[model samples]
Target: MDFFHGQDSLSILEWTLRAAVTFIFVIFTVKIMGQRAISQLRLLDFVIALMLGNIIAHPLSDQRIGLKGSVVATIVIIVLYLIGVFLSLKWPRLRKAINSTPFPLIKEGEILYKGLKRARLSIDDLLAELRKEKIEDVKKVALALWESDGEISFFLDPQFEAITPSFYQLQTEPFDLPQTIIREGRIDLSVLRKIGKEEEWLTHTLRSLHHTEVNNILLATIDSQNNMKVFLYV
Candidate 1:
């Protein structure tokens, strides 16, 4: 079946060329707009991207590009951008009057409820970002700023620590797990050598506990207190 229905249809080659041109145009247009397309996007940047995407899409699918349609749209977007930039520079008071600044959500380990209210952020929203950094208690957070781009910047206390799990109270630090020296009745000789210990030291330690063979041990660890914890099968 002929899809074009006798209309002057574009050959595959023509379609490929048109698609390539459109792709390049869109990429170049986006590049000209700066890195705001990905990072630190404000309300105006978002609106322009949406409108530009729509304008670019319409021409690709539509059968006709009228004499003045695309040119008019491009000119309008450029004009608006230039006007915004010009006005922002020429009149600082006007710019500040229009675009609001970032509000402080927290300061010195205290939540600014009034600022949160003004920023339209709930306690839950604030807590969620805190939780992302595995911070259960907000008391350890020194300062948290709500950026103008709607991102939360966290400044944690240097001495902040997470609450340890019940079974792992000795594990005060996250990456402080002790290396196993003995497991399932076998001596981890490699571990012993890595820690600068020898078979004689292991044997002497075992002799003190009335055991000579590693096979009798079920679990052994160098605890955080710098003590060897040996659990033997009874």
Candidate 2:
């Protein structure tokens, strides 16, 4: 007799139901935990999230680990989490150790090579991020930081004058979206009616931008100046 011979036979229906339940629980739990997703996650936060995922996935995939196992794992994680939270509160040094500090990437218009190396970032990557921030020139950057949460922040040189382009050149300003009036492809129909534009106008505008369907847009906004901005997922 084999120890593995008695493994539970999983049907497609069982798997599907388990997957759905796992997904819903994860989504709901994350919502309750607040919105520190991915790019905004600290190391400890990421680790906790990873453990939660594992806890949620185990009973869903493994027949041996039933709902009881999932509940036990969740309780253990919650207790550990509470302990961590209490410790972080009681000891500031422990909190600091858990949450690493942000590293400075640039200082006084020069790359802090030591910090950059520690951050595993190259000068070219710094330049690319600077350019993404609509800074056409690197000399304008006074300071930059690779934040602990993995977000990049930059400070500009106040004394350094912006480079002046020659006459007759049409310099394009960087694109920025306004405050969201509509979200998740849904028009705030109240605002639309108040602004004297119907759904037809929205459809037309999106069509102009090569978006034929409203579902294609991830976010849509209209500024106080009445300029509309639309964003789509790739």
Candidate 3:
């Protein structure tokens, strides 16, 4: 019994070592792979991620397999991934084979049933995604595309879109972008400096507006027109 217990304790220690090594190896691999490897993953990248999870998990729990084997397997997977990325960048045909192209879900205020069927998306799912974008009526949409990454991009009809000064043939003066001076009860010194305004000036301005405490302000902005907008916390 003592011999078995000693073996189990040694197994536990081995497992810990395996987990730690695999954890560090995965982190290093992700860093080398770059952000797009995880984020904005295409179908091929998604499959690889799933397979890699299974590959890493097996050695992590199994004490009989050596950590060196897991490390080697991981490195091999990363190398193949890098090679695939290079090929995808160089060859458009190969890229198309690995990742799906965007499909039109709607065009000219009309739902494309054929496109929806090809994407394997139901009307309810499409409507839910549209609602998330605050689009309730389908007629208001001029074009909607189901992106390769499974996101829906909406383009409103010209009539429904917000009218800009350009529509009226107006010559608008170029202005500086608005800078946030305060956000979430905190003063942004970088934004203050960017707007060429000093901290003392802000304090004085706030005081002039009967705002004695900066923390009391929830949000503040200085627009290109030199208009200072302040919203206080309730």
The best candidate by lDDT is 3
Write model 2 residue lDDT over 1-234, tens digit each, in one string. 222234455444444444345444553565444322445876556656777788789778877766754565566556666776789789988776655566777777777889867666677876777878898776678878877666788888976645556344768766655666567777788778667788887788778865557887788888656687777877
Per-candidate TM-scores read 0.46, 0.54, 0.68
Candidate 2 has a TM-score of 0.54
Q: Which ten residues in a row have the lowest lDDT in candidate 3?
A: 1-10
- Looking at candidate 2, what is the lDDT of residue 118? 65
Query: What's the lDDT for candidate 1?
Result: 0.66
Task: Report, for all candidates in order, the number of backbone clashes.
Answer: 0, 0, 0
lDDT of 3: 0.73
Of 2 and 3, the candidate ahead on lDDT is 3
lDDT of 1 by residue, 1-234 (tens): 232234455544444444344444553565454332334665445545766677667777886754244445655665565676688779978565434465678887899998787666789988988999887888888888776556778887877744448546564555557878889987888888777888788768877865556788888887554468788888
lDDT per residue (tens digit) for residues 105-173 in model 3: 999989999988766778998898889989989999999987766677899999998899999999988
* Residue-level lDDT for 124 in candidate 1: 94
Q: Candidate 2, residue 190: CA error in Å?
A: 3.8
RMSD of 3: 8.7
Clashing pairs in 1: none
